[model samples]
Target: MAALISGAIDLGGTKIEARLFDHAANTQDMRRVPTPRDNFDSFLAALVGQIRWLEQVAGDPSLPVAISIAGLIDPRTGIATASNIPVSGRNLSRELGEALGRDLPLINDCMAFAYSEAHGGAGEGAATVLGLILGTGVGAGFVIRGDLPPRHAGLAVEIGHLGMPARALARHGLPIWPCGCGRDACNENYTSGTGLRRIAEWAGLSDPDPVHVAGRAATDPEAARVMEIWADLTGEMLYSAQLMLDPQVIVVGGGLSNIPGLPERLTGALKRLRLGQVSLPDIRIAAHGDSSGARGAALMAKAGKA
Candidate 1:
């Protein structure tokens, strides 16, 4: 008999990815589709269609399904809030499950990334892992002893929304900018890929692509200055995180993490900010890359079954 498989979906701002995987987290089949940003009906249809397609392809009609979404779901109310997706204030799991005629587990994408890393990715041997995502935005999740801590009202680690340190802002001579979350000087406004682009633009760089900006830092004085400020701001945040969580390893995943020498730069920044004689945790790139979210969602479904 074939081993049982689980279905996983990673719902992002621009796309939705679905996959079929086994207990070992190996993908059996995968599919991707553009997300319907404004139409709820289209969004539901997209997800339902993908799952049905995967089921047909795998020849398994009863596989458990799990979702990793870039948003927060209130476990108490079952309502979800995703800025980019159209499911804000709706019971996504219930509605999506009803559409498919099966219950489905949903998790935050950052948490899923963290779980995947903590289990067998970059943080395999560590007792605690901090999964930090520096994508279009910033977000983090913590995994302790192979499990995620209980979240209340979907509020676990919202470090992105925290206020940026005044010292770092003043040192960089950057203005306090408003965040998408309606707050000024939030860390996401400066530490994410979007933030990097904004910083580059503020530094008078016509090219605001984060990758280009980071790549040109060695040659362009303006780009180098922007990188320095970005690194300082990010390093300050990580310093606070190190003090609070002290995870054995910090696994960085997202678009910005792919920049070459990012970990080394961050390490240098951290070393400069060191206050005591304590050593810092290992900073490693995520092992699973883009697939970590979907794969982790599948693992969550498998764990739920056991």
Candidate 2:
């Protein structure tokens, strides 16, 4: 039999990355193009073009394709909702599959990240892994034994949308802020990289970029204080997540995870909130970096084929 190969696409707000990979997650060929933001038709065309290009490069017209999209796809309705993409509320899977004459599995990007880490990246060897992303916004994926837990309505693990703990908000004198999701006091408003900037601004800092704030944490007392609160708020969320999921390992990814000494600071905060004799969960940085999404999509395709 011919070696099994699959095509994967990582669909983000700014760009779409397509790759062909073997069963082992090795990249065979890859291409990238700007994501179409003007209309759904243009966006669909871009995906069709990328998949066709991949099939041509592989010389296999029947290659399975999977997408890791920065959005949610309701399994019941096949409708997708992404803040950055134009496909919101559309049955993207059906449309794209019809255009290509093949079934295309759509996985949430964070879920893909978790699957990738659980298989061979940071969460390798762990029975349950929580892939946490702390970038412009916050999101997470829960995986157990190399597979995601069953999800209903595509929202089982939307931890970012949960409300902030009232006590924590009161402690920091922070007001409940509105979230893009049309809810107030969502965790994303206070724990994301954007949230870090919000904290900096609240503290009267001139620079609100999370990178600059984290960089100045060492010498700048105000910046240090901002990060401290950020860490505390972030830790509060993780504390609840840890209790709920009891994951064996928590893999941190996304831009904010790059902050220096972040894992240690988070661990410290967790220690402070320890309720009993439960051991602190192991926290590690993501190993696959940006490629994890695409690689994971390919892996999902390959697994489905099996």
Candidate 3:
């Protein structure tokens, strides 16, 4: 039998990307289309049209489409409860599948990231891997061997939304800042790119961008102090996650992960917070970088399931 093609859709608020991958989940072709944010129908139309376009390019109408979205979808109900997108609080996949005349496989953005890293990227060969995103916003996912841990009620490995560590909070004197997840003092509020800038603001720095702060951390004493606090906060978060998931490697991704010396800082903080715990996981950066989600979604297309 001929190998199947994997059609992947990475949906965001602003645009929808359509790509085709070979059996090994390597990209063969890709294109981008603007997202329709007016309503669910428009959103569905955007994605469905993109999928059909990809099929035409592949010259194979049987290509399975896999979708990656921001929030987790309820597996039992097929309901996608995403934020920032117009289709939030709706069963997007089932509806899209109905329109497309096929059973579409879907996964959360974070889960896709983890799956990509675990299977062939940074976490390859590890028994267990944690994909952590310190991106524009913080997120995380867990992959055991080559599989993602089963989620309960569409919630799994959402370590970033957990409350700020009490110790880190006490030491840093951070306020109860609001989070997009409708919570205050969440890990994402401190561990993400905005979080780093927030720390700069609290420290009275005029430049609230992470790039500026990271650039100055080498020579400016105050920037170093901010990073120290960030390290402490991230350390507590990772240590707490380790106590629960015990992953063999935590692969860090996202914009802030590009900050030089961040991996070292994160590892140093983890060590300081672990209380000398044994069997420490190697903290690492993502190998696939920004493409993990699309690639992993393509993998799901080939797998025929999440």
TM per prediction: 0.95, 0.95, 0.95
Model 2 stretches with alpha carbons more than 4 Å out: 1-4
List model 2 lDDT by residue over 127-196, tens digit each: 9999999888999998999888877888636889988899999999998899999999998899999999
Cα displacement (angstroms), candidate 3, residue 264, comes to 0.9
lDDT of each: 0.88, 0.89, 0.84
lDDT (tens digit, per residue) of candidate 1 on 165-243: 8998998789999999988999989999999999998988999899999998999998898899899889988888898
- Across 200-280, the per-residue lDDT of candidate 3 in tens digits comes to 999998887898998899999999999889888988889889999888999999898888987788888888777566777
Where does model 1 exceed 4 Å of error? 1-4
TM-score attained by model 1: 0.95
TM-score, candidate number 2: 0.95
The full ranking of all candidates by lDDT, starting with the best, is: 2, 1, 3
Clashes of 2: 0
Error at 271, model 2, angstroms: 1.3
